[model samples]
Target: MEITSVPFLNPEEYSLFCSFFQDFDNDGETSVNKSRKIDEKNKSLSEILEVIDETEIPTSKFEIPSSEFENRASEMGDWEQGRVRKGRNQSPATFHDGETAEDGGGQRRRLWVKERSKGWWKYLDSDECSDGEFRKAFRMSKGTFNMICDELESVVMKKNTMLRMAIPVRQRVAVCIYRLATGDPLRTVSSLFGLGISTCHKLVLEVCAAIRSVLMPKYLKWPDQERLQEIKTTFGSISGIPNVNGSIYTTHISIIAPKTNQEAYYNRKHTERNQKPSYSTTVQGLVDPRGVFTDVCIGYPGSMSDEQILEKSALSQRSKLGMLENTWVVGNSGYYLKDWVLVPYTHQNLSWSQHAFNQRLDELQMIAKDAFMRLKGRWGCLQKRTEVKLQELPMVLGACCVLHNICEMHNEEMDVELRFNLYDDEMELDSSRGISVNALQARDGIAHSLMHCK
Candidate 1:
């Protein structure tokens, strides 16, 4: 038989393959060796046929998978004679940076492993990224965002490891802010940032810690004596009440049930309002005249009343030390009346003095209330059921408060669409009269002055 061509094997490779067979001789071989050589040659031939058969079989993945390809190759008449020629060139699958490709399923091909595509964060960081878009995503203006990055750069900046370069400080801050701003899960953040889920989670906690450590002292703290004088004067001018130190209020931050103490986090007020089981942690804040937080007490159980959190706060300790002597931070009925703390008369009375006092104090309390509203509205993570562990809530929430102060300081107005209505249930105290005789007398004096003097 004469061999002119064989299907599949390319022409250039066939000459060398044929020479190997041409050089072999069977004359000196034993019977067992002869048997082995015949079997090996037959096996090789069968394997070649198997491969050709696979290519010829129809598959939905390819347009021409059947005899069309085989017909293009030579007939069996040429292949049986031992001639082999090169197969047609196939379009190779696309590759990226040495990574695999998303090939249409081919039998011999390995499916590509894809890296997560980063979409949102890139758009946010680009030059075309509008300040409005940036603010919408992060709930703060670009200047405010840059300021935060600059403040936290020293603490939050990362070092590159041998495996991969570290995420930039800005990105770390963005991850934390995005998670807080959108209240999205870490997996959602991971997809947006093209980061691993665990990496996103770690970044959030680390950046929040950095914010608490570095920015909190500067932006969110007890106002100094000079600062207090300004706050009191401004607050007095607005509310018609003298020596108004700060406006105090408390709000609940919804959260998932903690692993160990689930019942403690259960929020009865919110659960009742929503007509379903709900859990939360409390955030008590005291804001000055400008709706910037002067002090914040965070991460107490939702079950704890406003007064309970207040008792545990540094503001309470400051009062005891007489640092807040002769001045009052006004609260709602949720808190007891005290020398440093003032509550409006809870009793029903026709007296003009009591009515005027409650009205003025309630007006003053709105400063803290509005501050909490913006805090939750801006950092949406505080408004939603956060996925972070219970122990981590304090730092995360504390960071949110600090950021809130910074935005307020920068006069960053929240987008109108992002405005959140706050509804904090205030439980009326059992007794309106507090233990402090001085506080009771002082309340009377203020109430009389408001009605009679003003």
Candidate 2:
């Protein structure tokens, strides 16, 4: 038998034919010829078809059970490929009984057991989940968390109430307060804790108020008799010199205007202009030699001098508090209430032959000044910022004194030796100077009496 062959068209001829026949509706084998022409217009399609001609497709409708097909595909490492390419119209040769296509992807579903050994479990154990996850897990909003914390705090204050609120509230509040006390910037703290900046600021203020209300009265107070004795005992233990002279050390009240542009400019020209300035309120405090504070008063205008403030101070009403009349106050020249004030120990009382004695007295004053400097360095200078109000002043000063006492008690090895040597030198100088030993003794006796009475 003789086979007829069709002539193959050149590329240009095929292109022209496809362009013409793309819109053609010719029927029968002529249409198939036109389709062939369109396909041949692209050389890439021709090359692809050449490769496809070399491959084979299965002719029979063969049935391998789904399980068996999956096992075979797994062995061949084509299970994922098969699933990805498989069509919905064509029944798949393999099936996973409980598995579904996870979001129409190549990924296969398996039994998810929430394995505690891997993945999220590590983060969960470390409490290191992201904020979103934490919020979801705790079933809380940020506002809800704050409200819960407030509720817990209220319960803690009530004392007699049952713990109806959750414990997480207390834990969260403590964490918030700790961050605030560390002086972390509100914005940074808020971002870290997933809180608003305003919320963080409010939380800090409220927590500070809570601490002041709850802890101040119980832990901080004026130096009563018991506290004075404690202070005296502490001084004696470290200094080896008992506090026999318990003079009242009164601090001057000076309240300048708060730092501002106007104040700064006014201060610069005050002397030149001979300007009288407006002042804030005063802060008055009475301290002992051991730095134990008592009998604090405030609220006078700052324009008043130290003498005026002291005269009006509640310290003058010693008799009302059962305090003695003979208590001498060691103060600066501003407090020269001749009968009541003891100025810095004077050297004028020494005789001409007691030259070395005056020098020795000067040395003792220098040592005391150095000790005061050290104490000032530790406790810091008293400024308007440290003074709160009249009633609150005692507690503030008492807290500072307690801290000073702690340092004196625990870290006084060097200070004690220095003070002892200075005291001995001064005592020798006092004898040589023909200083009124009887009067000095009497003053000391009065101080000692006051210390004992307190």
Candidate 3:
């Protein structure tokens, strides 16, 4: 017997065979009957294949003539040209080349650069540019723009989750205020960002309130005994005194009034037609020699006398404590009180008064004057209202004192002259009007003798 081999079917033929077999139901239990049916189908398929292989047709039987072929080609060309013409007529006017479309009865289209004049390019709206030209003209970095857009999208999504309505404009306005308080000018800030001046002003006030509510408690603190001791040690070197006595400085307030009279102005004075006296709030602050603000009292009427302000100040109570029994305090003649506070150069010397008591009192006055002169050099006249309101004034004064003490401490031998001018230009003596100077001098002499014996 001779062995024969059959060639494998190509991909197309195998696919077709698989498709035919896929239609059969394999769930039937009659295996013999199913096999017989499959054999019959295979026989039919083989016979069809054999017929297709053996069949032959005449090439010229169904061929068209060359003239007919050319005629069909021309018909196709005509049909295509007609279709193109129909398309051009039905399309939008905006889509047509070389024709500008009006805004009415058509979509508004951006004008191209070539359609515009040379100078008109400068005035061209941003919407009129190609994507590339717009990006270049705006000078935006691709990465930065995308990152900003993404961040905005994320913020919008987060906001929408909790809010049913849009976020209010004031909530965004608050952000502007924060920038202003932290040191940004309102004019330069919102101009580029498209915000109005009034909005910026309100925002600044709101932010200031918020920050003050949080920060005021921590930064504004009262000084304790420890801090007072520290201040004493710091001022001691400069004053050449073993301990520090209290001091007081005075300042005034500024009142602003319009140059021209307005409806708001009411003239209290009937005689003086042009005179309008302005008014301002008066503030008094008591600070230690080290410039640590010990107490502050505000809301005194501008016309209140300096003596009245001092009498009401917390320093008045401190002075009553008898701390000045052996110590000295620095102040102007405004604080000149006989018994409680020591007005400088008020003590009298007599024949019985030891020379040492007079010398010590003179030395103390000199030291106080020296400190005042140094303060005056650094701070000019504290009487000025505008300069006092500058927030850095207190800090500058404190820092200068610290530096002065440090210099005095490190350089002990350097002799510096005391430079304060006395407030009273002339000494007044009235022997008959009051306790005679001679009697006061005798009392001081006795006190000094007793002090030396002790």
Candidate 4:
């Protein structure tokens, strides 16, 4: 008798093989231990043949009854071998991560639960989900989501599934926007939205870029003459701030320290918040009287002064070229005084007219502060440290402003509690010098006009 080459066996088969030998040994030690010690000469030919017969019988019918097998083998295999490999065809009776495979009927099944998949989308569609919850998760109402989806579906819609099934455009956009609106970490967004972290990160940039490309021109722009006049009327009614077109301000959006030019993004002001060096980027914006952004200029380093940023802004260039002819865009003293751009009077020895002029300017300056407060409040992502890369931060900022405009247009009610509280730094008086002579005359003229109106 001889042992022949054996084919590969499943864990059950392998376990049965070991069990057969154990049963034979346990039944009688002489059949196992004594047989191994017997010399060839002392062993009878009949005994050798009997031993071979017993071994051949089990090997011939290697398959055991299903009743004979237990799940212990799978458990032991996992404990001893570290991980138990399962057949691709096996289906788990119960599924979750770190779960052990179980024998179901005649088939072995693995408990493989896919992570970051399902649940959220279905919950969003269900009646059990509340509008408040939806707004908290998505930062917009269902109507707004559907509205945006209709506009952006063409660009972000999936056309092919060659590599893997693409996530639906609505979910992709919702998850990304939720992340941006909440400023949550990628993992937090992934877990909450039921998406892979990498997928969340990719979709965030994809959706943000899509938003900027599609919505920027429509929502965020310089108002047309009619709209400008409308805005001017609103400002004029505020405190006789005549010919007022828009109010400009610079708000800082926090970001992680950049890999290159780390110092450039480092925010000198945020250092005291955590008692450590921090980084942020300045978002210079000009808003209409309704607290909607009309002009947005992002991507400047945090360390740059408002004067420097305004000097380099397209609005400044346009003003210099008479694009803003006979318009008054008021700003805080952080900005330099120009004929078109007006800032509050900063003289220590101020007359009654000058005081009245500064008072009116201060009232106008609240527009910028109120605009920023509402913008950050409505979209909380801007209120905290954003995790986007420096190169992509401008696009993210632009998309936020675009959405802010959308919310304003649709009369989206802001969450008062979520609004960013004004810090002392936000209230700091600007020390920029050198007002233009023409700009000085303009300020004095407005001041005298206010006095006469009084």
Clashes of each: 7, 1, 1, 0
Using TM-score as the measure, what is the rank order of every candidate, best first? Answer: 1, 4, 2, 3
Query: How far off is residue 58 in model 4, in Å?
Result: 16
Candidate 4 per-residue lDDT over residues 302-344, each given as its tens digit: 8777878888888888888887888899988777788898888
Question: After best superposition, candidate 1 residue 444: deviation in angstroms?
Answer: 1.4
The local distance difference test score of model 4 is 0.76
Worst 10 residues of 3 by lDDT: 262-271
Report residue 357 deviation for candidate 1 (angstroms): 1.4
- Candidate 4, residue 103: Cα displacement in angstroms equals 30
Ranking by lDDT: 1, 4, 2, 3
Best by lDDT: 1
Candidate-wise lDDT, in order: 0.80, 0.41, 0.41, 0.76
Predicted candidate 3 versus true structure: per-residue lDDT over 265-300, tens digit per residue? 222221133264533333444445544334444444
Better of 3 and 4 by TM-score: 4
Q: How many backbone overlaps does candidate 3 show?
A: 1
Summarize candidate 2's per-residue lDDT along 2-113 as a digit string, tens digits.
3344335567655655665554555555767777755665554566456556655443434446897786776456445675334322322222122233324434333322
As for candidate 3, its clashing pairs are 353-445
Structural similarity to truth (TM-score) of each candidate: 0.75, 0.35, 0.33, 0.74
Off by over 4 Å in 3: 1-196, 200-216, 241-245, 257-278, 317-329, 338-343, 346-454
For model 1, residues 1-454, the per-residue Cα lDDT tens digits are: 2224334585644654574465345578688877776677667667765766776633443355467558656455445555322211133332322322322343122323346776778789888899988988888888889988998999998775322346788889999999989998877889999888988899999999999899988988787789889988998888778888898999988887777888888888888899999988888888888898888888889888898889999999988897888888899889998878888787675488889888988888877888888888888887777777888889999998898889889999888777889877886556734378888888998888888874
